[model samples]
Structures are given as structure tokens and as C-alpha cells.
Target: MTGTASARRSASPFSRAGVLGIVLVGFAAFIALLYFISAGDTGDRGNTGAAHASATGLNGYAGLVRLLENEQFDVTLSRTPSGLETTDLLILTPPLYSDPEDIAQILEARDYLGPTMVILPKWSASGPPNNLPAETADKFKDGWVALGSANTLQWTSELPAPFALTQKIETLEDDEVPQWSGLDQSGEVPTKTIAYAEQSALHDPLITDQSGHILALSVLGEEDSEYYNNAHWTVFVVEPDLVNNYGLSRQENAAAAIALVQQAGYEGDYSAVTFDLTLNGFGGAENLLTLAFRPPFLAATLCLILAMLSIAWRAFLRFGPAAIGGPEIAFGKKQLVSNGAGLIVRARRFGLLAAPYADLSARRLASRLGLIKHDAEAIDAALAVRLPEEEPYSLRADRLREARSSTEILRAAQALRELEGKLAK
Candidate 1:
């Protein structure tokens, strides 16, 4: 029975290990959640037939992005406002209904970076709303848009000063279609509706029709003006179909699109292309999730992970034994005294111990001093003669015998033991 209890005691009945395991597991799950939140860009980028770069819809420039990537130019689809502030050539494909001020803000930021291309919208495309039955919604493939009639952007004149957009969409006769040419490549615009921004002194025409209305043009100004003296230039694509997915099926159009991207994005030995998605509603604000994984904060994140690992290791493995427990029923003099003390405590009999403990100390001291008579006066006189500096044994024993609380009894008993020791010395 004793061996059984000792074996049981060896492995703690309390679940110190189990509780620690729970804590470590909880911490790991919390870190995993934080990582998931911060791991990727936020927004719904799924194809809903929008004209942004991420969409494969006919009006979208996704094919243009793919062509740039295939041509080895560094291409990025930016969903944050920060993407606008870069030296790389930025392509803006803002929706017709978007705020002109937002577009102005982007251009103002890029004044130092230099060069941007604004593609005005022409096609009014739409997809079936999801409120329809799921079975019907599933029938339509992703990014499929029903092409509506080409419409002119009415709000283009509301842009920043010195820019006024008077755009026209003309449909030429069957045998009268001539290609627009620039950038050493030429491509035919769709005859059903050919779009152009009316020529003005502010425009430097890069691509144009036979009549010479601007299909694509660079912003121009006086020699000393910032537009002319800035690090690069800005071009506007009046026609949406020139580089959109609708025109990409033709080899000539595809080649022309490639040349246009290179010409616009070119700066140094090598230049990259970036497509803006913020205006198309894919933008996300910078928050804790974004900051934690960047810069000085990234170092802090790694340190936090290391701390968690160290704590888990400490919890999983023991460096030293906690304690070595004794048997259920121990033997010998020490155990006997411990058992007696426990009984006295349980019965509230602390006062009963004082008198007996002092009596026992007196007997032991008398025996040690080689005294025959153990009367109170005799023993005290002997102690006085033997150790003059010590308090007499009779006084210490009387204090011990009268003590009611455990603290008083312990102090009185200690004095008697010290006197006995000094006399023997």
C-alpha cells in the first residue's frame, strides 16, 4: 500500500503538465490567427466584369498586364494608395463615375515621380446581379460582360486645371477603316465605335486617326513649365478598346499594346509597369495587420514568435525535479514527532504541548549537567553557576509552560535549548 501511494505521488496528481500544454496550444492558435489576418492583401478581387487590370472582362486591360509580364517588365496591380507614389509608370483605369478629385490626388503625388497614363472609359459593361437564383448565376462564366453601346465620359472636363476633355465616338463606314499608328506599331480600332479626345495645344499626339484627332497623346506645356521639365511624361488613351481585352485577340493590336507599354513605362536602363486598382474599388487602408509584417515592426514580430517558442519549450520539458515526496506512512523519531504535532493542531490543543515540552527540556538539561535533583530551584541554581551570561533555565521553562499561542511557545522553548547548549560548552 505504501509503495502504491509513493508511486502515485511520483507522478503528480495535479495536472501541471496538462495545464501548461493548454496554455501553449492557446498561444500558438492566437499567433496563427494574427498571421492569417496580416498575411495577404485585403479586398474582393474576384472577377465581376469590371474594367480593372485584375478582370478578364472585354473592357478590362488584364491582357495588357499579362503581355507586360510576359515581356519581362515588373508588373504590379496596386490595391493600396501607396502604389500611386512610385517612379514606375502607373496606368490609371478609373471608372467613369469615380471622383475626379481622387484621380487628381494621384496625379499630384506622381508630380515628383513623373509619368502616368490615364485611360478614359468607353464601354458600358455589366454582369447579371447575384440576387438571381444561384443556379442561374452559375450558368454565366466568370468575368463575362454583356457589351453595351459605347458612351462618352461626360465628367472628363471636371479634371484639374488646363485640361478639358471633349471626346467623340465615331463609327466609320465598312470600307473606310484606316489604322491608327504610333510607337513603331499600328493597330485598327473597332469601326463600330472609334473614340478620340479632340486635339488641343496641351496635347502632343502619339497615336491618332487619319483626320488626326488624338487616340493617345502626351500632356505638353511651355519649355519652363513643370509638365515639360519634369522627370517624365503623361499619356492619355482616349479609346478603351485599343489595349483592352476586346482588341487583344488581334496580333497587330497585341504588338502595338506591347510597344505602347514599353514607351510609357521607360525611364532608365530598365523600367516596370504598374496598374492602379484603388480607383476600381480594390483599395485597402494600412492598419496593424499591414504594419506588423513590415520594417522595424517585422523584427518585433519575429522576436515575439521566438519568445513564444521558448515559453513552449520550457513548458514541455522539465529542467529540474519539482519535489521528492515522502512515503504515505514514514517511520522513525522525526515522523513520530510530526504525527504528534499534527494531532495536537487538529484537536486545537496547542496549550497542552507547552507544559509537556518544557518539562522534557528540563529533564534533558538536568541529565546533561549531571545533576541528581531536578527540582526547579536546584536546576536553576546549577544553570546560573554553570553559565552566568544565560537567562536561568527556571524562567525560560516557566515562560514556555505558560505560553498559550504557538508563537509564544516556540520563542520560550528556543531560549531553554540555547541555555542548555551554552552550559554544555
Candidate 2:
């Protein structure tokens, strides 16, 4: 017994406090990792598309976004539908293949919310092909596209009631300088062809070219609540080159672009101008992984992290004395006999148990009373000296030996066991 106590305990490689420190630090680091990953990017590819606010292509309007930002205006690239309903200015640059109903639905919802500007797509743009020459590929810039051809949107001609529009492309020669006048500013478009909307009786013209073709149109809602809640102005830019990156290259066009955004949808000094990207397919949807690190849920996530740290602490520092592992098999005659009895029981030999149990009980009682002879009568005489009121051991032994049925054998064995236990006591 002293051997276990006398041995010196080997020092643990890490103490309990050190282990707790490691667990807390590791948990904090894991939480930091999740937070950073969730907050880094909403999976929006930078300046990759041809016409979205995030793109830098000639047909894209990212330059306009930068220009507005430089002018101290709050500009946002909206990836969700909720951003489209801002009570300020919302700019939409939907692709050519976009659904007209979807566009109409967005406008219908935002009728009372804010002023919206729809700059229709004009150029069919694409990236450099795989068969591009090395010199040409080297010249190609990232997020820059090749302007293939000029076109018009089908929805422009099928706008909501009393707002029908149609467009005709006009090719400009190198010598021809077709100037546009709008927003009290004049600018010459930088593209080879200018797509201008034809005359429409339903809408008022904001900007017109030298040919009097409408470059921009503003549909005003009647003050009557049946037609509209208020006098809302929905500006439509037919030729995107008037405000696209190619158009913004000219200082005059840049000024005109900013004028169109501010004068048309001016809300307040700090009212935001939201540029939509969902129609161009850069939408950020709700997700469990993202929500866990965001507001409201972040508090619960932190609580869970704390609970984990507490669990680790409880496991590392134990209470009371350390319990040494016990032997796999207990060291006792009872266990040895139990193994033997289990084997005997498995053999289905009930008759063999009664005689052995009686003999064993007699020997145990005889040894306990210091009797030399282990016979049933001798054990009975010795046990009677210890306790005179007990049943005779010889009588119990005869009954157990003569037992034939399984029930009689079990009953006799139980009686012998009880008698031995009383003598032992």
C-alpha cells in the first residue's frame, strides 16, 4: 500500500493554469477567424462585370461611382433588393437580357420611396478570347472589356403605361462631333455610335442632342393620388455612353454625369446614391454562417464560446484527490467463485450445485469455529456452541444432497448459504 504513496509524481508538461490559458487563447483566435472571414467580402468580384457598379469596363459605370465618392456623396453598390428602396437616389444599370417585369416591379415599388434613374445598356461587351495574341493579351487590362456593338433594351419601348420609348442608333464619323445638352451642361459623347430615344408624347425630355433626339427623359407623375402619391421624377438615360466609363473620359461628360445624379434625384445634403448590382448578378443573400457573426446572433455566438471555455476549464482542473485506476478483475475469493459458478450455471447442471454448496458451507462454518473435522455433524455441533438457537447444519446438508428438482436444489442451497452467513457473523 505504501509503495503507491511513496513514489514521486512526475511533473506534467503543461500545468492546469497553462492549459486553461491555451484553451482561452485558442478559442478567442477561432472566434476572430470567423469574424474576419464573415466581414471580409460578400463574395462580390471586384470590377469584373461589364456594366454593374463594381465593373471597370468601358460600358461599366464604376468611374461614375468613384466620381460621386470624390464629390463627398454617399454612394453604395446595392446587392440586395432592400437597398433599391432607399428614400434618396437609386441608379439601375440592368443587363440587356434582364427581365422587363422585374425592372417594372422595382420601379413600381419605389414610386413613393425615392427618385430612380435607369441607364439602359448600349454596348455588347466581352473579355479577351483564349486565342488572343501574347502582345494583345499583355495590353489587355483586368476588368476591361472590348466594346463589340451598340444596341437597345426591349423594355425601353415597353415601359409602364403612358411611358413608351424606342431607340435608334446613330453612327458618328471621326469628323462629326455630335454634342449633347442636358442639366445646364453640354458634352460630346466619346463613343463611335450614340443610341438616342425617339420622340415620345408620354414623357418630358431632360437632355437632347443636336438632332433633338432625346438623350434623357424624365417621366413625371401627376400630383393626384390616383396616378401617384407625389410629383415623382423617374429619369431614363437612353445612351449609356453619356455616363459610362468611355463617356466619363471627357471632363464635360463627367460634369454632366454628376449633374444628372444630383439635380435629378437630389434628396438632401447627405442623402445617399445607391447603385444596384443584383440585376447584374452580384447579390448577397442571408446565410447561417454569415448570420452567426452578425448582430443579435453575435451575442449568442460569444456566449457559446464562453460556455465552451468553461467546459474546458472544468475538464482540465479536477476536484478532490486523483482516483487511481482499480484492477480489471477484483482480487477476492468471491469473484473467483463467481467465475466458477457462472461456468457451472452455463453448463445447465443444477443437480451438481447442491452437494458442492452444502460441502463448502460446512467446511467454512467448521473452520470459523476452529473445528478440526469438516463433517456436517461436527460443523453443526461447533455452530451450536456459538449459537444454540440455530438449525442443525447436518439436517440442512442432508436436504441439499437429497434435492432432485432445480427449485429444491436452489432452495436448499439458499438455506445453507444463510446458515453459513449467521455462523460467520
Candidate 3:
């Protein structure tokens, strides 16, 4: 008996609390998995293009990223535009084929974002060919060219007019090295020349080449700028080659890049430097889920979550104990009759039961009238005498005995019921 009771208990479903706990655990596990998959650090901290900071290509800025990390600066590669909405220094290295209007939108949206540096694209490069041996392929050179011609400034023309490229590539003389403070010039500078441009009156010169064209310009913010105000500082670097992979190969160029980062006010702080990948053809795609959790639809997401929680709470509160059924063989005549009728109907034997039921009804009626020894015919004749002349009880009894289908049985049974009512009267 104890073993049977224990088995029944073990086979039962979980209680409300137990089910709730299981659901909560499953939800937590799902959230943890999502976080690990989406945001875990795999250490590729640069743009997605072939020659950006994350790439190992000759024109990439991976060396610059390493150099900054070596200097104890926290540098993160941001794959989404939301990562740009911070107080850190944001560096954007847009590709040559990128839309200028899109770049303009990103810049315009950075009203409250901290110091931003836009590095003008300088190299036209392609990836190495596929047919070479692994060692030779790994050492393949990226076919890069300096964008010094006027026609190559089409993309730059779409930028804010003050930061536009000027079709001039100024070559620095050996005696005309930059005099910027904090720049380490002990080692060789990779390229003596870089793309040059003129800045507006609002901009201040940070670095210049031999021909006096500005290579770097900065626009500082006001002293008491409000949050999200349009007064944040913006820096424009005319030549990216000065800090890219080939350039950073020279220790002097790497040092110069570090100095420029410090000049942008990220000298000592970790998590203060962020590189942008959205413009380099990475991660900016938005879907329904992403849109729902963003600004305009965030309230909708909250409402949906609340509705789900409310339903769950209601379900938990309304949960009741399991219901136990009665035995298959129930007591009482009404139940027995119902069960017998159900069995006859299920077996399609209603017509066969019609004659037997009529005889039993007649015998019961005769006994109720104190004529216990009378047979079915005598009971039917007595019923006919009591019933109306238009509907004879004997005729109903005969029809019930001769019924050959469920439909005929139903009609005869209904007539017999009417005859019984008349006989009772």
C-alpha cells in the first residue's frame, strides 16, 4: 500500500510553485545565453572592412589599436551606432565607398556625444589573391594608392564644408617635421606626405605639413555646455595613413597616433576610446526586435512584458488541486439506467433493445396496478383501455416489438412513453 501511494505521488504533476520555479530558471538561462552570445569578448576590436583597425591588411589600423592598448588606454570596437552615444572619444574610419549623407547623419546625431575624431580615408586597396600558397598568401601586399587627385575627393565633398578635402597632398621635408607637443619623433615617420585641407575660422590647427595646409583641425566645446547640446568638440584628421597599419609600422607614427589620442582627451582613462564599425559595413542592421527595444517603442516592450507577467500571476493564483474521478461502477438505479443506455447506443443495439424494454415496461406497469401475474399482451390491452382512442397503447406495444431500425425504435419508444402517461392518468 505504501509503495502504491508513493508511485501515485511520483506520477503526479508538479505543484504551482515548482512549475513557477522551473519557468523562472529557464528564463534566466535563456537571458544568460543571449548575453554571452551577443556581448562576450572575443577580442576582435576594430571595423569589419579589409583595411580597418581590426584587419591585418597593410592599410589597416590594427597596429594603432595595439599601440593604444600598450599605452594603457581602454580601446573598444563598437559595432553599433548606440555605442557612439557616450562620453568617450569616438574614432570613425569610414570606407571610400560609404555614403556621405549617412556619415553626415552620424556626425549630426553626436550632439551630446563626447569628443569625436573623423579620419579621412586615404588608401584604395584590395585583398590578396586566393591561389597563392599559405605562407606566400599571408605575406601578400595590399595594392594601396594615395588618394591625392581632385577626382578622389567626391566622397569628402559631402562632408561639412569646413572639413572638406582640398585636392592637395603636401610632402613634408626632412627639416619640416611636425612640432606638435607630446609627439615622439625619435623613430622614422612612415610617410613624409599626407592629404591636406583648409579649415574654417571656427577650427584650430593641431598639425600641419610643409606647405602650411592643415593636416588636423579641432573645434573645442564651450566651458558650460549642457547635456546633449551641440557644443561638443569635433576633430578632423585629413590623412588616415599617418596612423594606419603601414604607418604604425614606424614607431614614430605609432607615437604620433598615441599623442593625437591624448590630444582628444583620452590620455589616462580606460574605456575612454571607442572605434566605430557601423560605417565600415558592420552590424547596423535593425529588425523588429531591435526596433521594439529602442527609444520610440521601448514603452511598448515594457507593456508587453507586464501583460505576460500579469497573465502568469493570474494563472498561478487560480491553480487548484487535481480532481479525482469516481469509480466506473457507480451506485443507484438512474446511473445504472444511464450507463446501460449509453452502452446500448455505443453498440448500435437500440433497435434490438426496443422489444425487451417494452415488455419490461409492461410488466412493471401491471405490477404497479396490482395485476402482477398478467403478461405483456394483457398489460398492453389494459393500457389501451385507459389511453385515447386515436392513439392505442396496443399499437405502440406492437410497433416497439416489431421495430427494425434506431429511427423506428425511437418513434415507438416516444409513443410508449405517451401511453404510459395516459395509463398513469
Candidate 4:
């Protein structure tokens, strides 16, 4: 008995409090871990693309930004038209200008600005069709050429020897009195020929106009100049292989394209490449950071902080014991049934149930007999008429009397129940 009492005392209010604390703290720690995993590192800092593009810094355009800096020019590579105004001689590359909408916008800007040199690199074909209006196409046709032989050079064979590129050329045409021998098809119109390939095993003569003006010359001997008015406003080079980055990366090809551009009389201030974020109303440096801190993240942070504070407050504030008689206690199933049985036995032993049971049986019997009146006199009369047999009626009457005695009450109740079943049938 003493050990049992000790065990009961050991499970006290303070011990229960400690267990609750462990559970609450463990849950809070789990929640905290989830929050950190989802949020990652929030305070990481680096140069924003806008800041880098605007500062003439090297962080904006990936690796190529370094190359532009090394060449002593500022490049702001932008997606917006207004950004294009910040520099002269825009050098467009793939991807950024690959979309038709962006390309059309850039081309539209050409008429307003000075002459621009478009370098058709090898992968330039991925861009959408210019679909430029016929008028615009004619105006810019001579200026723009796909980098291949049949398009720019008049004949396939007239192209220079010792050089082989990957394109098919059908025929070569002649200058007035120039040789067209052994060549069947006519050459590309002269209006489109800016420069043709001249170096070949066959005599790929360099052809020019009657004014000693060289139309297509060897890529190896391309020249540079300060004025474009010396020729027309536009110059077409049949194969820009001499100008694209793939070729320009090599010393020989790079120098050649630069010289040709210069010889075409393109002189302008080369500085900053701008990146346009105006389409998103996120032009300045703060826009990117603003997007990073939008509403959902803000709400989640607030909820986390509130939960932590609630936990800490509950930990420190005292939790008084639950009040006495706070809620009614519930008995076990067996205990409740036993209590009901005891009440019934006590009522029968004192004969307290005789009057109530007799009254109940009479009313029930009257109801079963379909009699409107259900007094004792009425029930007895109805039973006499319906049963007509005296024995069963007498037995019922005797059982009702016996219900007052403690020992015989159950027998009396059973007889009344049996009579009720018979009447129901």
C-alpha cells in the first residue's frame, strides 16, 4: 500500500508540466528547421544586373563583358530600344536579339539612328523572319546579306583559290568583255554583290566597277577607311565568315572584319551595353530585390515570428492547475450499468415500484387493445373483453400485485413483459 501511494505521488502536476514542455519544444524546433530549409540564405549579396550594366562593370554580360572592356569600349547589352541609344555601333549576338519582336524593334530603330553594321554570325539563322515591309526590305536589301557565296559572289568558280568553305555556288558571271566561258548560269545581280570570294585554284579575278572601284576583293586583302561616303551608304560582304566571332577569334580573320568595317567609314563612340528591364517596370537596381521580397514570403515570415513569440510567452507565463469540479467526471461502462441495477433492486425491495409498474402495465395494455380511455378500470375492462379467458387475465392481475415484493418483483416484471408480447402478436 505504501509503494502504491508513493507511485501515485510521483505522477504530480510538476512532472506532467515537464513532459508537456518537452513535447512543445520538440515541435517548435521541428518547425524552425523547416522554415530555415525553405528560406535558404536570405542575406546573400552580389552586384545586380542593372547596377553592373550601368556602372561599366564586368558583371553584366557574363564572360564577354571582359572582352569588350579589354577592347577599350563600354558595352551595355540591353533588350530595350531606349537602352540602344546609350551607344553607337550596336554589336548584336545570338539569343538576346533572337526573338522576332526584339529584332523588329532593333531594326525599326535603325532608320532613326545612324548606319549600323550587322555581323551575320554562323548561328544567326535561328532568329525569326525579318518579314520587313517590301519598301524597308528594298532599302536595306544591299546592306543586309546572308553570309554565303551564291548570295554575294557572282559565280561559284570565280571565288579565290586556296580557300574552301561549306556552300554550293552554281555559276560565275563576267564584267563587260570579262570571261563567262565554261559557266552556264548567270551570276548574282551586281546590286547585291558587296564582296566576293576571289582566292581559288582557278583564276578567281578580283572584279570592280569601271571607275576602278573594287566590288569584291580577297578577304585576305580587305582594307580599312574613315569615310563611308567614298562608296554608297551600304556595303555587302558575301561571306561574313571573315567578320563573325568564330573567325574573328583568330588574329587573321578578326583584323580583316575590323578593317572592313573601318574601311566602310564607320566611326562612332563605342561605349556601354545596356540591358533593358523596362518591360517589367523593374528598371532600376532595387526592382530585382523588390521581386525577391514579394508578399507570400513576407506573410510566412510574420507567421513564423508570431508562433515563436507565442511559444516563448507560454513557456515563461505560469499555467495554474485546472479548477476543481471543472467538468463532470464520467463513470466506466460497467460501473454505470451496476449503479442502474442497484437502483432498480432498492425500489423493488421497498415496494416503491408496485404503484408505478401497475399503472404503467394498465396504460400499455389499454394502448395495445386500441382503447381511447386508459385508466385502471378501462384497461381491466378491455383485457376482459379481448382475452375472454380468465386464467391469463388472472395471472396478469396477480403479477401486478407481486411487483411490490423485493424477491418476486423480477418474476412479476417478466410476466408483464410476456403478456405484452402475446398481446402484440
> How many collisions per candidate?
0, 0, 0, 20
Q: What ranking of all candidate models by lDDT puts the best one first?
A: 2, 1, 3, 4
Which of the two candidates, 3 or 4, achieves a greater lDDT against the reference?
Answer: 3
Models sorted by TM-score, best on top: 2, 1, 3, 4
Candidate 3's error at 231, in angstroms?
Answer: 2.4
Q: Cα deviation of 114 in candidate 4 (Å)? A: 6.9
- The most accurate candidate by TM-score is 2
State the weakest 10-residue window (summed lDDT) of model 3.
142-151
Identify the candidate with maximal lDDT.
2
On residues 42-68, what C-alpha lDDT tens digit does candidate 3 reach at each position? Answer: 344432235565666656777878888
lDDT of 4 by residue, 1-425 (tens): 66665665555557556767876899777766554433332232232212222222211223334454565555554444455454354443322123444444553454345334433222222111369677766664222233232232222232222122222222333444221111111122222223333333221223333333333332221234222113122223333334443333445443444444443334333343333333312232322333335786777766866998788668545343433342353588987867766887766454666556766876787789898876756666777777666335445656667665566776776677776777898
lDDT of 1 by residue, 57-120 (tens): 7898888899878888898987777788877889999887867777777766776785788888
Give the range where candidate 4 is weakest over 10 consecutive residues by summed lDDT: 178-187
Clashing pairs in 3: none
Report the C-alpha displacement of residue 225, candidate 1, in angstroms.
2.9
Looking at model 4, residue 338 earns an lDDT score of: 75
Selected candidate, larger TM-score, 1 vs 2: 2
Tally clashes: model 3.
0
Which of 1 and 4 is ahead in lDDT?
A: 1
CA shift of 300, model 3, Å:
13
Who is ahead in lDDT, 1 or 3? 1
